[model samples]
Structure formats: C-alpha cells, structure tokens
Target: MMHRTQRQIRTDEPSVAAEALSVTHVTHGLTVEDSGEGFAFEERVRGTALLSLESTRCTGTLSGAVEPGRAMMIVWVKSGSAVVDDNPVKVGRPVLYRQDPQRFRWVDVQHDVLRIDRTIVEQVAAERGDWAPGPLEFRPRHVPEGAPLAAWWLMVRSVAQEVLQGPADVPVERERELARFAAGGLLTAIPHWPVGQHEPVMASTARFARAETFLLDHATEQITVNDVAEAAGLSVRGVQAAFQRHHGITPTMYLRRIRLLLAREQLEAGDDRSVAEIARATGFAHLGRFAGSYRQEFGELPRQTALAARE
Candidate 1:
C-alpha cells in the first residue's frame, strides 16, 4: 500500500530549510512523512498522498494537515518531541488521533513519522461506530524517557519487517489491522478531553459475528438473499435489517458496494477479464446495470477506467 504525496524542497529560505513530503500507503491506510533531509521521494498510490524524508535529524518543526474525509490518522513518532498547538506531545510511541470540523487541529509528530491507513479506520469505524475514537485535541503527557510509543513502534516495525522479510501470506491488510488495534488501545488509554464522538459498535457487533464473516467469505460468489438469510439463520427481512442497522445500508446495497469496489480494483489492476465477465464473476450478471453502477460509482465506465489505468 502506498499513497501518492506531494513533495517540495526549499534549501535557501530561512523560514524553511528543506522538505520531502510523502503520503505513504501502508497496508490498510495512508501515512505522510515530511522531513528535510539531504534528498526527497514522492509517489502516488490510489490517489492518496505520501511524504518521506531520508532522516528526521534534519527536520525542524514537522507538521501535518489532514482533510475532512480522511478517516483518522494514527501517528507513530520514532523519535523527537511533537507540539500540537504549543502543547508538547510525547513522541516515539504511536498516537492514534482524529479531527473534526468543530475541533480543527494542528499536529506535530516531531521525528521519524509514519501515518496509519485511514481507509481501514473509516471502514471499521463506519461499521463499528461506537468503538471509534473521537477527534483529537491538545494534550500534554509526561514522557517516560527512552520508552517511545512502544506498542506503535513494534507494530510499525513488524509491518516494515514483513514487507522486507515476509511472503505472500503477509498481506497489507493484516499489518494494517495490527496497527489499528494497537492505536485504538493507545487512544483509549489517553486522558479525557472535549472532542467529537465516533461510533465503533459495528466493529464490536461484527467481531466474531457470523453474518459479517459469512458476507466476507462469500462476497465474490452469486450469493442470493435467501442463501444469506439461511446461512445466518435469520429471515431475509431480519438479515436486511441487520445490515441496515449495523452498516447504515441495506443488505443488497452493501453487497453491491463491496462487489463494485472489488470490480474497480480488478479493473485498475488490468485483470484480463472483460467488464461483463468481471461483473458476473463478482455476482452481478446484468451487464447494463453493472456498467451503469460502475460509471456512477467511479465516474467512468469499467472499460474506460481500465483503459485509462493501462495508459
């Protein structure tokens, strides 16, 4: 996973020395690393942003601004101290944070920064609203020197190590989940502050919940309403209600959304299958409807998206 980030370098200006900003795509989310080292690197992944610096030692007063729809950000500070609006935040440990319109924020992750995946945060948060952490605000906590945010460091290290050391079984999503869980724990442990709320009930309700498991397992097949209902031992209406209550959407709509999302990925990746073939493979048999839905959701026909991607 890698996000495309904007990069800028300014060596002569007194106000700013040098800068390399990258919005990195790490399994399940986006992270931005900005540092003014001797060099810079930037690339785009799935249309998101990423920034990277060769080293944090040259970084002076690092800061990040996240847009409104960007789920939440989990900041992992490998070194240095960060000040969010003049308040010093302990660095080195992973800090899970979010922001809302009412509570706009300015974060300084200080040194050796890694931004976690927002997609996973938003996805899980959307489904599990109650467990979601609220928007971030300034909080100053004492640092137990030399002990950076250990949990976050370990999680990031493990993911990085896997990227360098593991095999196909080590999917990015798994690494992303590990990071999310670790960050969620840290956020939960932090002290109270006035902030907007997030719902995480979907996560809790879907955790070990049979319906969710079944939906994920069978997302690619021609699963019918009756089949899903039977599998979950509920009436069709009951299952439909469950999806609506949990995901804020109807069951059929949820299925289509997931299917379309999968189809889009396949299309972008240049999968050999044709649009109709891919749609059918993902359980949508009607070519016209599939194409129309694809166009509406992605702002382009399936074939067009694939063609553009190939170019």
Candidate 2:
C-alpha cells in the first residue's frame, strides 16, 4: 500500500479530465475528447493493478496504446454501449487485448465503462519466481460463461473490493497474496506463450532459514533488501516471497525487529550512548516512526525501556 494515496480526480469540465487523462500513469496513454454529450469521470485507486470507472453520456472516442503482453486491458459496460478496438463491445463482458493498442480506439455511443488494467504484471512477476518463455500473445475473444469463469471473476472483484473497503494496514503476506491474485489471475486468464508456460518457483523453507541466518548475523548493521538478497543467493523478489510465505513478515521488517531488540540489549546493559544515539545505531533513521513501532512492539517507549533498566 502507498504511504500517501490520491483517490479522486476533480474536473469541473469534461474537457479538463481529457487533459488529465492524456498523461500516462499506471493506466495507459489514453486520449478522451468531448463529443458534446458531456462526460463524468471519477477514479479511485490503491496500489498497483488499478480498477477505474469511466462514465460517458455523450459520443466520444478513447484512443490509446499499452505495451503488448506486459499487461491485459479489460473493459466492462454495466450500462450504455461502446465500440472498443473496432469491435462492437459486448455489454457486461470482458474484452482482452495483447498487443500495444496504439490503433485501438473506443467510441462511446451513450455508454458507462469500467476498466481493469493489469499493467503491473511485470512488477509482480519479478517478485515471484522467473520463467523462460517465447513471445507471449493474447488473442481477443469472449470468455464463455461457466463455473471456472465465475470463480475467476469473483477473485478479480474480490481484489477490487479489498482495495476499496479493506483495512489500510495489512500484513506482508496479505499484500503478497493480493498482488499474486492481481498478476497471477491475469497471467492465467489471458493467452500467453513462453511467459506463462513455465511454473513459478516456490522454493522450500530452507531458503528462508538461510536468509534468517544472514539477517541475524548482520542485524546490528545497516542492511537493505538487496544486501539480504545477495546473502541468500536469491533475487530480491524471490527472497521477498520466501520470507513472506514462511514468516508472514518481510525480511526488512524482521531485520528491523531484531535490530530493535539488539538496541534494547545495549540500553539494558547501561551503555553510555543516548537514546537517539542508540536509535541511530539500530538502523532507524526516522526516530519518530521507530519510537511508534517500538512502542507497539514492546508496549513502552524506547526511553521508558532504557530508564526502566536503569531503575
């Protein structure tokens, strides 16, 4: 999740939103023009793999292009009608595209639209294990109704639901699971070749044991995820998945926890260093957040812990 989140976009005029949408963010390089029927736009997003709602009352064309195979573009019309990528888009059905949609244009003929772009697939895939495959391709077709489709649809909606109404702060394992669903689900649903052919490597718990050894050995030193990854002989993402899966917490957080414990040892031993000095030595650059987390973990402030030992 983001430390700071921007939920809604403000547009007093339809053309103003057109200008805002012109610039590319996590979505796509989209261009919207007012067809004189008026347009209403509001988008709320949290984390990657965004879900957007675009409602159009007038006639307009939405033209843009996204990179091929890196992501999937899906649009569902709950009401109204639209023409997407030169096909008369089916109402309440998902339309999939694999290639960069430069020529892909959508004409909203009195339509309301919901778009889901799995644009962060590459990022998520990097965190999981790697696979070697040829060029991936997704042929455009309708997903037929069935039990399998229903389950997948529910999974997709659940992710969106989690973002909209779920708790702001969740565990690392929870974050990993949500990201897996967003990226993993799209990778399976879309038609891809080599990239999707090989299974993701979920290494055994032994990798976590090795990583834990390294973190404990260097818990007092300033360390990074990359440093931990190098010590474990695994990619950064691989270590992340392993730690979260095995421990339900991230490697970095675990390191921080141990560092705090080590700092407390120093304080209890009547070290000459001040509390701030101890904090700096413990690899906590932000004194405030460190105190907050420390209080939550130990049920007392760092200074209080230090003073208690002295008493």
User: Which numbered prediction scores highest in TM-score against the true structure?
Assistant: 2
Candidate 1 ranges beyond 4 A from true positions: 1-208
133-209: candidate 2 lDDT, tens digit per residue: 23443434646332223323544555666765666655655655665555544543343333444431321124444
For all candidates in order, the CA lDDT equals 0.47, 0.54
> Tens digits of per-residue lDDT for model 1 on 71-136?
444444545555543555554444444443222122222343444444444443333333344443
**In model 1, what is the error at residue 279, expressed in angstroms?**
1.6
Question: How well does candidate 2 match the true structure, expressed as C-alpha RMSD?
Answer: 17.5
lDDT of 1: 0.47
Cand. 2 TM to true fold: 0.47
